[model samples]
Target: MDLSEILIRPIQTEKADILREKNRTYEFHVRKDANKIDIAKAVESVFNVKVDSVHTVIRKGKAKRLGRFESQYPDRKRAYVTLHSGHKLDIFEGA
Candidate 1:
């Protein structure tokens, strides 16, 4: 898959923000089929930051029901990208 198809969006919250600022780790919502290398490249391409490592987690979709019907939400993958020293994403810079 293309780099664009690997990364979906950033997850920006107080906890994640703190990690980004202090630990150089950033979180992202990514395609379920995407892996470490694909995720690293996508992060590099999208944020223009050099990635040191990539960790992924496949979050199982939660189950739901509507009376007689039962279904599960779509499972998704999340990536934890570690940036090289002295590099940071621009989006979190001004915040």
Candidate 2:
């Protein structure tokens, strides 16, 4: 898979921010079909950082009802990438 297609976007929630600062971990929204290896490579190429580990989480869509109307949110795949010490992604720095 192409690197651009593998990583969808960076996830910048409060918990992710804390992890980035404390553990050198970064979070990204990845393609649904992407695996750990694909994610690690994509992060390394795009950010120019050495990855120590890659962890993935699949979040299932939740069903919701509003006034007897039922709907479901899209399922999402998240990747947690840990960088080798001394390597930092520019996107996560200075902010």
Candidate 3:
């Protein structure tokens, strides 16, 4: 998969914001098929930062019922990228 497609978007919740400030790891909503190596490369290429490691998780979809219809949310993937010490991604800087 392309780097751009691998990285869907940054998770901008309160927990993610706190981690960004106090931790060296950043969370991203990534492609379902992307692996750790791909995630690491994509993060490094897109953010211009040095990546130490990448961990991924598959978020299973949830089933819901509305009226007489049943629907399910799409399954997705997430990547937690740990950058090398003294390095940080500038995309979220000043935000």
User: What lDDT score belongs to each candidate, Candidate 1 first?
Assistant: 0.88, 0.91, 0.87
**Best lDDT among the predictions, by candidate number:** 2
Per-residue CA lDDT of candidate 2, range 1-95, in tens? 79889998999889999999999999999999998988988888887889999999999999999998999999999999999999998887765
User: Which one is best on TM-score?
Assistant: 2
Residue range 1-95, candidate 3, lDDT tens digits: 68878899998788888877877889999988888988898888887889998888899999999999999999989888889999997777775
Looking at model 2, the pairs that clash are none
Q: What are the candidates' C-alpha RMSDs?
A: 1.4, 1.2, 1.3
Instruction: Look at candidate 3 and tell me the lDDT of residue 36.
Output: 91
Question: Candidate 1: where is the Cα deviation over 4 Å?
Answer: none
Candidate 1 vs candidate 2: the TM-score winner is 2
- Give one digit per residue, the lDDT tens place, for model 1 in 28-94: 9998888798888888887788999998988999999999999999988888899999998888777
Clashing pairs in 3: none
TM-score of each: 0.89, 0.92, 0.90
